[model samples]
Target: MVKKCFFFFSFLFSLTFGQRVIFGDDMSNLPGSWTLGGTPGNYWTQKSNRWFSHSHSVKCTPYDNYNNSVDVWMMRSVNISGYNLGVLTFWVWQKTEGNDFCQCQYSTDGGTNWVTLWQRAGDYSSWQAITLTNLPNNANRIRFRFYSDGSGNDEGVYIDDVILYGVNRTTTRIFLENGNYFPEGWTLGGNYNWTKVTYRYKSSPNSVKCSPINGYGYYNNQDNWIDRYFSLTNYDYGLLQFWIYYDTQNPQDSLLIQYRSGGNWFTFATFSGYANWTNYSYNIPNTADGLRFRFISDGTTTYDGVYLDDITFDGVSTPWIDLTTLSIDSPPGLVEFNDTVSVSATVANFSPYVIGTPVYYRIGNFYNALRIVDPVQPYTTVSVNFPDWIVTQPPGTYLKRCSTAYYRDSIPNNNSLTGTVTVVGNFDVGTIQIISPTGTIDSGQTVNPSAKVKNFGEGTVDFNVKLTIGSYSNTQPVSQLAPNEERVINFDPWTAQSRGNITVKCSTQLTNDINPGNDKMEGSVFVRVLDVGTIAIISPTGTIDSGIIIPKAKVKNFGNTNVDFNAKFTIGSYSDVQPVTQLAPNEERIVNFSPWVGSRGNYTAQCSTELSGDMNSGNDKASGGFSVRVRDCGIVSFVIPYDNMPVGEYNPRVRFTNFGTEIANFTARIRIGDYVGNATINNL
Candidate 1:
């Protein structure tokens, strides 16, 4: 059995102490291994009688006048770059009045430049150990100093047991805050007057409070900035985390995160809305060795401002892996029962260095596969496939998860992912869908209905398929349908005898089919009447000359049935009839008729057909009219021949009649006695 593996990566912090301390002093003498500075007489001195824990401690005091300010300093030298993590620990008792405080700072350029690390005010009753964090992880020629700002009347300050030690870096946590004091090395600007107050904190005791001082509503346009810079050159990757409490009601009040780039501040993110000690983390760019970060608050005049605590800048060395994506490799469609499934995921390395780790995969109760990623480069992803998993669980859905383990992952939330996979058990099931025989079918016609049968279950099957059309139903047998396969089944011909809407259904009757809801399907189709009627005369439809006795009328059938009718045509008082025998639908015939003779005038020719049951009478009759003009036929009567005309040129007198139609001029060839000649008779 192959073991399914999963890995989870998280940042683990381990502090290893150095066997030999670089420098240690009990401060028995007046600055034995230390240098002193500031206002001449008010410098650091060893007080053997007034000390805590040890025999003697160093002390510093301010003048009784509150007008002057001074920082009497005591210094020691050590190289902080020699170890992965360097800590400066000491015991101190401070008794300062008002706003005056004792501070610890470090110098890199032999006391030329200084960076404050911690500050303490008021008083400390007993010896308290102070650990200054967020110091430069890699800095040579570094010197630590303790100083006091001399203002107001106070009992001065004392320090004992100063120790500097280096440790092997596992995971370093550089906290910018020490107990209830405000963080040092941070600069405040604009209308922001922030102070570390012990009133309200997520962890209790202390949190930095920021507010507007110019009377609430009037400070609506006030903007504040808090900035801190660090030298995190020792670590390759960095993450900045902090907690904040704010009101989400005020939309305008916001905290904007900014970073310094090319001497100018660029905003990286903006946070607004209500939260209670919500932890937020941001990735620090690799190019940011000397990175400086600032948080700006704009608005919040009427409402309360923000309280911040637990500011930390954590760093990771290299080669971190995070599982970004997870999935179950199934077929193109839905998963079926007993099918082979493979789990796969994509893992990403967000670190600057290459990583090699073990990746694990598991689905439900079964462990699927284990793989070792050889070399996952920085900011890239590697896809891993697990071993083949036969879905043995009962038919349902199960969650599948994959993960990878790495030494350091700043974001552990993205180290694993869970997805769902459905398993269909080994059984025969089908989904029947009626897709055809759902439109207007001609009456008394046979139509073949079609349906799609899909294997929606896990195994090959042989089932009985049934089709129903209206009141008629039939069953057919189908054999060997593979899983997830579809086939179209055509039923035997179904005859539609009449006009109405009817139902078409298809179903599969299998003994092993588990899902009965998808085994049957239904649809609707329409059947139309076959008999329709339309008759019209296509010819002899326009104006024409009227003397056409035997005019032709063409009759056509525009229906779906064969029709037999009597075709009748009439023009003026003349009418004729013809019998049309068994004219098929969409067929035409020429009907000729003779009209009675009439006087010259305009007459209408009407043509129609009389069927037994005509569907449309509007197309049964068609009529047209024409102007009638009679032709002239010349007639001559009562001819008087000239007696005894002997071949002489003489005019023959005759009575002529224009009997046909119009007034006419007649030319006659006369033969009286012996005269045979052509003559033009003028209008008679």
Candidate 2:
């Protein structure tokens, strides 16, 4: 960190000194005051990295070889005979190794009489402030030399902010804040918060911190501001200066400065990511007597926001033309269909010495360039309104930006502003719903279907509404429905003759409707015939005997109505019957045919449903041949060691148990993958 230079005030008038000459080089170009000598490796050249200001800084490269050191000097000649208590002040940054050194020397009798003022040896990685005291007031035509002897693997040195002043010069300080207390005349902003904090990169013990906390529930485009109001009416020429450290860049976070003059605000400067604590000075116009300064963040909060310190408003005596402000004005929002709107902007001159030239203003796709006349003085703001401005966009929302351009605008941040507008149409309609009947209905039965339509857009609508299902269709005319209003329309009663699933569709047809995607809807329905019943024997339907056995049959109502019937089974002289009650539509049930006692012989067996009014009786009765035989009623079997066997193939042992009253003769089958084999086992 570079130390601040302060003047020591004394009670004696002759001992008081003030700043006379201040020169700061951002290395945007070569310095005019100093003469360069020795080898040039951009050693004393401009660069973008490790700078104390914006964009570029001066870099001095050290010699790499340890055999012999290389020498270089940047010298400036000045006359100090008129003023006493002369002081030399500047900033230095260096990284040096052993035996590498730099010295500050002054020569009174040209280069032949050189005298050493200060020297440094070894390594230094940070920027240091150098102030030479007790300079000889009588020395005239003296040259100051910055000599460097570089050796070994060292990174070199950097020099900036050189000032030479005496006790005779006068200066006025309008404002100063060194982080020890809150600033006066400045107000904290809304939306985002700014606080005083101490960071390792800060210039002093503390600096002002502003961070746009924009994650989680927070959104972007936050308009946070910090403002200060003061009167700059006394003098015509001055400057507004401050030091800042920025942490990030555009599309992420941004820091902007803007000030108000003559009741209209204008942007001064905008900065993006990764910058050191650098100083900036802007010329103040005489017409900016009542000025309001503001700082804003665009809400892309990342890393750290911005640190601001050492804000000063100084009164200077120089002549330079400066274009201060540019802003958009009077743009239309919520325009009706095909309606026109006017666009306008404002521009201001903040310099008293130079008159303005041609300035350009652009709104959306339109642009205009106007020339500034001689009568316009400093602090005077002029509004340029485009005469043929119109809104030609279709009905929707659009974001438009307004911008201004002038070659003399030293600060370009406040030159543009963005906003959104909406357009609307006259007639629109929507189909809210299409609904089918909630409960079951029989085929060939008349049922009422319904649909709903609404005017969810602007104005009332008179349109055709249609409802259709398969071959049945109906259409109706809606007289008038206001916005956000809905009405239910019913179709003529139609019979669903087909079986299975079907779809009913409802739609609206309006020629001028702006949004047609929401004009149609669909719903599902199921249909079948009434009073149709079906019954079938599912198991043991062939070669059955009349004995103590549990037989099964299925009875179903395949229609839309309830059914009540009796299931009967018969084998020659043996027979049994069971009643089935209230089997609803599309339902199936099983019936057991058991406890049949008969003699051994060939016979015919039948299974059927007995219903008085049964429809489709072709599946109601089923018949098959049966032969009475002596056989086992039931048997159980198992294979030993069901799991965890060796990989090789093996036929495991088998065991059988007769769970019935008689001995059983059966054939067993074993299968794996696609292989199969059978073996017969009797008398189990």
Candidate 3:
């Protein structure tokens, strides 16, 4: 009876070293906090069976002359974290039963079972080393369990040389022991959240980090930022741009891009918090060749320090790049039926992506259903027939947008490109066209405006060609516009009456842009009515599952005289809006925001129209966000030898577990740091 005593180290070795070695040889001795082996004749002891060796050569392999029934084997302890992995291998030979084979197993619950790795047979002794590639990168004790399978015979059975290799994965972590500091004018973000701030891979090039930054909750303290002046030397620059992330919960927080200018630092660009590490890029100009960079936290109390990583910057930064806008666009200040409106987008050679077909553009919604560059003209601007998609759509705001991510492998840009789009809401107003004034209308002159409005949206219902007269006011419903058809609206000299100045608005039903930032449009006009223009959102701005509702807006005239107006809004499918009226020259009102629940994507609402007395105009929309990804914890699926795996003092146990998603490869035994016997993780 083998009475075995075992002890295990529950804590990890706090060895602040460069790399860790995992050669799971079953050598049980004091002072060795690693090596957790159990059961004799297990995979670990197989290393002494004339097959194991320090080197990976079959020439005079030590295990080749083994007189025992065991072949070569080895393993080590590995703590599985997020997507961990390693590669290993072992010696091969024919068993006493003339079978040539072995297997590797892993145990997550304190090590007790023996599972199968990979099995090799038929002249196993002649083979140098049997390799197991995709080893699961997780926490568990891996062991090599060899089996004769009736193929291990001494007659021609020969064995030798075990070898193993592994891939070392790097993670973003604060050593706590090693930290850097910043001076005055500059500040450290997150206080201690470690979630904010930024991290640099290998600095100097001032390139955005390519690797994704690590974070768990809503804040970040790992403010890995670059200096204000890195001095972009002509030497080969490797890192270009860094990957950064900030919680959008704080409105003041932005991608505060900074540059060394005018002998001081200033902002270059400020992207909002609602941005991701996706199709975003930033680089320094060759003219400012000797400058540095750092993420600036917008000094907002309730904010997270930015996080950044994976930077790639070099000579004359590639002219080609990925161009992804906020996915929204606005051209016709206010879209009115019979009015021809054109949304213009400007592209430059600063990015290599524009190098392709004379700066062409791909148009489509978020559904991966894209329509490649169909330019109305050529070169710079990409035009879309707005009224066209609307009237054609069912009954929702059909936002249209376009972007470009370079090919992943190609020098300019090459790799997989991913994007998102949405065909939101249920209202569909067909094609939209705004007719610009052929002759310019002066400050308070009468203007006849018309737009060819279509149900470019998805819904079916009464489509009206609306016209607003002021800066921010709802439109007046005019009675002449058909789906997929055109109509014109004539206004009385000097439009509707409203206070302040007035603008023209002609919105169909909905306005859906691939990007949400720029989604509203209004026509050109000016007027001075006695009171503020009549305006109302009539619908909520934002929608979701778990959260507060977005607000609504409305404006009316307290004082009166004639006034021209324009207005646009984002609402639900209800299509009902309360009009704004009453008041003298000095009165104001705030619209109550009433949010609603619905599916994911964009939505809008509007109650716009045109009136003859000096028109008033209004435009407002709502936007917010939610996450679509959820991280998962790995599992310990299978093991062997049933609980209490019996073993000799120097024997090793073989264990195996599944990684769940992808297959892991290995050539050595995996184990916990505590073991009384030897162990080995070999080919199954």
Candidate 4:
């Protein structure tokens, strides 16, 4: 995981112990010990396209889409037998389907059974740090597994910079005594010709020689090397000192000193030509775990090779001092613009070294530097004060940062801290919102209008809020509203006189308000009076029979007040009036007119309301047309032979009449018991 920011403290503290990296990998090269399995085709592989720390990282389903129903994993097992507690940290970039998951698991009983540590499913655009803490004492193995369902596939997950830290560990040094034999942990490689020689010695007894024998030229095409490995964990600085004497062919046959870090070796220094036995010291990286001395000879020429002795490697714990910003002590909370106030920060030293450094503080574009004249002792805290600062920027919030300048600081992550400060005007007030009389209102009724006012300044304020709607206006006073406080002000009651949509405004009136942009607010209200109108003609519509037809109309009260009105209905030259009694607000009623003798023709019908104070006249009247057709026909009388005659086929006399003014042709059938007769008549 990557470090983000520093944390500061104002109390004395000591550095007791530090975390040591027990096992880690930068993923530069694939490790031989780590194994990858599950999901035959799609597996986790090492790629160099995206990484967190080094040049490479392990990615699941690299270069192509992952196969469905895959459970691929990359795992490594570590032997944490002696360590009590450990913390595992790593970074990952994942983009998968909603149901697909990326899981981190650990195992204690080898690679047999696993316990889940963390799992997540969804999209993460950037790399995110993940830390697993409180691992069991017997935990040893860790693995990353990606499971995909049989659905949406996307760019898979990438992992990098995996590290495991062990607590309560101490640092150790590596050294070799002057003797006639090689050390226990040391090994010889290549030609294996390196041995201890008595004649050429850097110390008292003897020194290891890379040549065949004394006073003899080395063999041609010779390559011999010796190396030793050490556990250089928990250390931040290291120095390697050794005595060397080289007498090889200049630039052709030489000895190379190299160190190994992260399983890769690099040359630190190269020596050639005749040189006396001299003490040499070189800085070694804290991450280095092994050192080597290799001697190479060309096929042409070679000399008395190289000799080394009295080799020593020591891990040094240097003086480290950390400065932390605790707090900004002056002008707390909020401040007014253009006002001067002293700025200071409480700082602490968390190491065992005396610190004499400068503290720098900044607020937006304004910054200043102050020095800590007296040396801060080990594990002590002090306050550093800068010059007074005047707030000149606009009314808003700014970030305030305080940092310490210490060149010899070991841990630089805790050097600075940041906070926020808000600036406001000295006297400012504004109207927040209108509280009452907003949506709809009734005319000739007294309404109480109210609004919410706020004090947006640094001090208490006294102001007046005024509410206006057309010609009617009222004002209310608010006294001593504290900073960042709000109050709802209600003005005197006003009677509404007009109709339709009217704009209502509320504003704050102060003597010297710094900000007036939010001082006023406007809203709308729909005003309505007593109104009753005909909505529709419910009866005598479409087609009807020609006779005494009755007309009906639907009327509604579209106002705030109730009233009694008369509705008039008319069809051709015939008209009638119906009285509606006590109609409630927003209510509807149906009015029926007297019967009218309508003839056989197409006629237009009209209905209207007669309310004296109808505010909206647009919906007072409604008209419609209907067509009446005369198609009446009936039989006046019928004669049958012998009312109770016997069951036999017989003819009967019948009479028919067409009440309509058109010709009629039809057929008639008569049946009595089992006897039946039929007749067809035309043009009566």
Candidate 5:
């Protein structure tokens, strides 16, 4: 119900004056000018359960729940004096706790100081429509407070359908002629049983039937109604067309369309299941004075119940000039190929008067003409450039419209406005990766190789970048390259005389290159010569708790020259030898052996690298495995019962370990055929 952080004001006077619903309420009952203040018994009530439109709603600690140190208040007192600006809609449903609030105050005298205008505090699970906008034209009292403190309490606020709008400028018209049935001032309350039906009419032999027929009184829990009254004092803007036909019992038997303003009654609209003569319009609140047509029913089901007719009520002034085409702000959604781009468009004058249009601007099949010449008031918004665009169009997506010719314009479906652009590909150079001869390279090594060239289109480019391999090609020369520029190139040093996996490509020789699929790039390198490997055995891995055991290896020198090796460090049956001295070429060393005295067994730890012109002798050996426990624990792998038995009821699992040096306690057992299970193990 309350979770504040609001700010979205947008009310250009609802687009220059013309909205009217002077004051409203739909709480259905309790409305003797509404008063109920401050926590009397936790005031404010009228709840017909919970409603946003018809049944009822206006609760704030209605029956129970909301207590703790409540602070209720519901006030009302609106005259809107002469309306300078006003708009305060409503429909809320809140439940509070935490900072517990609900406030929506106003009041400029009359009820003493107040001024909040919207506050919230917690869960707002659903209905939320609050509109309030720049009010205070001498604030005429409005309220809703519901604060709490002593701790927690919920289900607090739920005010629905309240409204209040002002601002009028006179303009009137009204008609009802259905062969003049009850059309004098029109009135017929609750069970008057509306009649005058010639089978049904939208504008002919007469229509207006809610009952007096067969189907409508079947379930008979009806609450019929029909009203008319309309003075609209000085009018602001209104429109209330009609033409209805129905077959009730849809959403629990319906039909409700109210509007009374200032003295309450709000229900905007609602209908039932089947419709036919359908035509409905609404928006009449220039301080509305009346117009209702209820038709409820709910004891059971019933159909074919309503059928209103051509009732018109327009009083809207007529001065519209909406020409919107809001966006296509210039040359930027990506262009390049021939690139010229300047094109702009952002039109918008959501009508109320002042226009003077001539904005065409297209792009794709090209077309341009912009002449707004000032004068575009109302809600104003301009920015029309259109003229540069040159993008020869080749690589994809294009559209981009933007029209507005304003003549008798009153919203010609929003004039025009399309958008999309993306051309790309003027010269596009490529190859953006492959830096240096990757991975292992040794056979007489010389290596320089580099790559990474970019410049993807739009001018400036002087490329050359090539760097094959295996047949050893070179070429480097990239000179200008601007436009997303990259550039790394470096070739010229090739020597690795052929040995094994080679590939390595790298291209980009621009000269009319129009997207050759990103030029080229491939990679791989591995030449070799005298090698010397071993690579890893550093310290007896995994499990060991016995005694002195120094045995390491890791030798490297995949040679190109400078080499000297010996490595070797067995285990299990014990063996040792180390000597790796001048290891230079690709160099890496760590070979120490000579101290071995172990116990409790589970060993296999080889490590070799003899090297005497090795020449890739299968990477010169390396193995591993260790275990010299002083007290071990077991089970290492077997999750849940495994051999496809599919019978059910099972919880046995396993994956245990404790290759130990002390601290061990255990008990684990599992069997299938005879079904046996046990598990208990700790400290190891």
Candidate 6:
């Protein structure tokens, strides 16, 4: 067995003070050095004393004062940051019959000046740390002032330990938001190159003094400035604000920020006066590469140097950016007529910004794409709708475009993404229409002319039914009609600007111009002298049923000259129509019979006029019921499985559903034209 005996002894001794350090349980003379101020003993009071302590604290004693009175402190120097130094925050323990008060003050220029960074005077039942966290970057001396206002029974206060923080700058540190920033006073503006720099500050009292680098020193010197630099590749905005320490010694100091470009510096702001640190704002479009800032002493003589710290830079936002407004970036791809073209685009969200938010994407014109900016988070891209006539595109290059997006605003500032962009393109010539004239018609009359518009020399025009004039019952204003649809355009000579040829231009947006089909309805109408029957709307204007041919006539004679009426009128949408030129004297002819191409509603027929020998002559004679509306070609709607079946002759496996109330005729040709789908002719 190993002889293991631990030797341990507990000693207890109580003795007097003199050559032997006391060690007693009564804790009277067994003292090591627990100082309240410069004495190691049980001594506490509220007064003005102490400079620095070995415990290295900044706390001092508290004194009594009236409610309106403040404790006056006298200290040494201070410096403006490069970093926060140290402070021995003072504290007081009061028996508060009411609220107690404590204040921390620093006098950088001796007892002559003092600046209060923090103060507290609420309930003081316990001890509190009246902090001096705002120590200048070069604060050399400091002090603490305490007050009671003598409200309650003057129960007084008790103070003890006075600790001095920041005795070592190597290991001292202040806590900050991990990812978040200090918002202001952190980021610099212009170029902070020793000469001119902008440093942000926390806050300050009105009057202060310092040597150089301390917060108090910076506040007092106030000669230099801070700045930053950034490139403006396109168009962007920069907004700024700052906190400044205003003092009486610096009666007239101004704060300034400038933009430097083209060898000239433009000052963006100028803040002046005598007050504590506060905030001010400014905005500018940074279209250049260089920007500078300054915080100078603009007083008559050498005004106290303006202590300038903390300058911030941010961008502005344009919230109205819609994806539809976005254009292709860079030398935009061009196109001509009858060619293939392909181009890409950037779609903007026009919404607020989130930290790591995702962007959405869209392809064709599908409505579903709008829900998300992009299918993939990283790439948000869309394509342009290619028009028919496209031409040649240069090799190995993208088109110039502009982005329409609003920048998400944040704490500092918001911005708009108004940037220049480049996109890949297959450029070609765009299709165009001939902008001349289409047809001719007498004044006060209506005419339907065929404006020739074509993309591929042979492609037929395709238009939706809802886009036609008939669908709106012609109540709509003068506008362009879809392909194959009849347009009843009245020539209002009363409103004509010229006399010769009154050209009623088709809507410029029509697809065809020269051909009068789309995008460009172009043709000239020969403005002729007015006619009596010219005002008469064509009755049964289209092909009439060979079985029901009963025609009515209208007679309006205006001319004093005499003439014979003999002309045949026919009826049909595009079926031939004739005019009856010969007729009896003052007698109105009533037509009662359908034309060979008759249907239901109304149509125009060739009125073969056989004038009687007894007929009177005049420029205006019996004219007619040319206005016609064909009723129903068995208005049929054939529903194929898919609403968008391709064009072909293979029957489409369809069902015939009639919207009209009448039997259709299979003998009647199954017309496959325009946008109407191929229909199965029904046997009546």
**How would you order the candidates by lDDT, starting with the best?**
4, 5, 1, 2, 3, 6
Please list all clashing residue pairs in model 5, or write none if there are none: 1-123, 1-124, 2-121, 2-122, 20-285, 21-285, 663-684
Winning model by lDDT: 4
Q: Is candidate 1 or candidate 5 better by lDDT?
A: 5
Residue pairs in collision within model 1: 5-360, 5-361, 6-360, 7-404, 248-274, 337-424
Write down the TM-score of every candidate: 0.41, 0.26, 0.18, 0.33, 0.28, 0.22
In candidate 6, position 38 carries an lDDT of 22
Clashing pairs in 4: none
Error of 6 at 478 (Å): 5.6
Task: Return whichever of 1 and 3 wins on TM-score.
Answer: 1
What tens digits encode model 3's per-residue C-alpha lDDT throughout 1-684? 010110111112221111112343212221133342333433233133332322222211133333344444444466633333444544455533334344555555545543344544454444354555344455366655443433234422333322222333322211111112222123333333222123422222222321123323333322333342334444222123344444443545444556664566656655545434422234354344332333333333434334344422333212223333222343322343333334333332233222221111222321111122322221243432222222222222334333332121123332122232233343344324456432234344445555545433233334434445553333434333333344444433343333334455566544342222222345553334433543554334433333344445555553344333333333455332444444334454554434544444455455343333433334222233332122222324325434576763434435455432224444444454563333443332
Higher lDDT: candidate 2 or 4? 4
Which window of 10 residues has the lowest lDDT sum in candidate 2?
Answer: 3-12
Q: Which candidate would rank higher by TM-score, 3 or 4?
A: 4
Give the range where candidate 1 is weakest over 10 consecutive residues by summed lDDT: 1-10
Residue-level lDDT of model 4, residues 595-674, one tens digit each, is 98878888899999998867778999999999887876676777766667797655687777888755667787777667
TM-score of 1: 0.41
Badly placed stretches (over 4 Å) of model 5 are: 1-238, 241-312, 315-359, 364-397, 400-428, 441-451, 456-484, 487-518, 521-523, 527-574, 578-684
lDDT tens digits by residue: candidate 6, 1-684: 010110011112222111100111111111223223222221223332321111112222233423322233323233333332333434445543344454455545543455555555544656553433334435444544554443443444433333233311221111111111222222333222122222323432111121133232233334554434554443245444444554434335555667767667788555455665543434455574454546554325443334443343444322222233344332234333334444344443333311111111221211101111222122233433322213322222222322221122222122112332122222111123322233443334443332333232222222211111111111113222332434333321132223345444434222323433334333454544322332232455344343444444344323222335434444444333334444332334443333343444543343343334322234323333332233344425444335677766554344444444356654332434443444347543
Candidate number with greatest TM-score:
1
Separately for all candidates shown, the number of backbone clashes (residues 3 or more apart, or on different chains) is: 6, 4, 263, 0, 7, 166
Please list the C-alpha lDDT of all candidates, in the order they appear: 0.61, 0.58, 0.36, 0.74, 0.72, 0.34
TM-score of 4: 0.33
Q: If ranked by TM-score, best first, what sequence of candidates would result? A: 1, 4, 5, 2, 6, 3
lDDT of 1: 0.61
